[model samples]
Target: MQKISQKSIHKYLRHDKKFPHVWCPGCSNGIVLGAVIRAIAELDLKKDNIAMVSGIGCSSRMPVYADFNTLHSLHGRAIAYATGVKMYKPEMDVVVITGDGDATAIGGNHFIHAARRNIDLTVILINNYIYGMTGGQYSPTTPHGDKATTTPYGNIDPTFDICKLAIGAGATFVARTSAYHAVETQSFIKQAFKHKGFSLVEIISACPVIYGRLNKKGDAPTMMKQMKDDVIPIKQYEKLSPEQRVNKQTRGIFINDTEKMEYTLAYQELIDSLKVPKGDSNE
Candidate 1:
């Protein structure tokens, strides 16, 4: 891929209309947005050919700032909306931007079923471990014993391994990365766009104002450093002993299956199969 510049990325953003994004001072959503823009620019994709759909959340606010064919739908319905866009115009690249609560909590069914159907949609799930925009509530991916507005003492719920869920749900392309690793995140996004079936890139992001403050995870910089230290590449993580792997997360592609037919393509094939021959007439 050709090298991208900060100035070039501006072309993809609605900076003139949506200046000064709404994310917190130390939030990681900006980093993820940068990665997304860079990925699209690197691919040289036409803005008209891409449909960016998002649900209600801080992350969902991204599409409003982007210059693509965009949709800001209801909470937990980004995937469903994106699916419709993909089905109607299978030639367009549909990207779904969603948050932990928006995607896995209220939208878990949509997320899983999209994977099961193997539709060609790139899902960028930003896992911040808490409901940042709504409140300081604990989310599905919140770590066990973590503090939150709802769990003042500590949360006892076990966290969801997003990558594992996507793989098990049959997403043809599954990968994990953090906001700190901007280059890797962009690379994974590019890969997801190229994949033929359901593609999920779960980006572990930071919500320093809410989740970090409640959990005593320090400021945004500290949280970013923690992300750098806590997550190891999948290849290196595989070499660690069981004990060493504890409390650690792995980054890298978990699966990329090319055999399964994409839902849109399969549906088109079915439509074609039902069509009568050009010269044949059935009385």
Candidate 2:
């Protein structure tokens, strides 16, 4: 793969209009954005052919900065809008930028159904544990014992394993990586873009301002270092004993099923089947 330079990826950004992004200093959203830009640059995809869709959240602000056909949609509705875009213009590459609360909470139904249909869309779900943008509420993926503004004492809810959820929902391509692992994240995203059906990349991101301050996870660099230590490669994780695997997160492609037919193609096939022969139309 060719090395991507910061200058090269600038063309993909709306630098003049969206300069000084809204994300907090040291927020991993920027890291994810860099990975995404690098991946698109590596793929050599046209800017016009890509559509960046986002819902409400800090991560969801990505579409505002990207120069692609961007759609900043309602809370938890990025997938729904992306599905419409894909159905209407199946040729365009639709990428959804969403956060933990925005994706697995109110948007849960849309997320599952889209995966169940196996539509052609790339969903980059940034899991930052708490609802960083909406006042640090505990999200669907917040750890059971984590502290959030909503859960002052501590959370009692079990966290959702995003990759497993996607796989169970019938997404053809599912992967997980952290913002700390930029190279791996970029590689997975590239693979997701190339996949023909529903693809999800769950990126473990950091919200140092809110989630970090609440959970005492330390500064952004410390959190990133912890991620480097905690998330292991899937191959290495599989080799570990059950006891050894405790509290460890694995990063890598979890699923890539190429056999299932894409939703748009199937819909088009159904449309073609319904059409009567050219000379055999009912009078």
Model 2 RMSD vs true structure: 1.9
Global lDDT scores for all candidate models: 0.92, 0.93
- Backbone clash count for every predicted candidate, in the order shown: 0, 0
Residue 203 of model 2 has an lDDT of 92
Q: Which candidate tops TM-score?
A: 1
Residue 110, candidate 1: Cα error in Å is 0.4
Task: Estimate, for each residue in 1-283, the C-alpha lDDT of model 1 and write its tens digit.
Answer: 5689989988998967587889998898999889998999988889999999999989999999999999999999999999999999999999999999998999999999999999999999998999998778998999999998999889999888988888899999999999999899999999998899999999999899999999889999999999999878998898999999887899999899999999999999999999988866754
Model 1: colliding residue pairs: none
Q: Report each candidate's C-alpha RMSD, comma-separated, in the order given.
A: 1.6, 1.9
| Model 2 per-residue lDDT tens digits across residues 139-178 | 9988888999989999999989988999999999999999
TM-scores for candidates 1 onward, in order: 0.97, 0.96
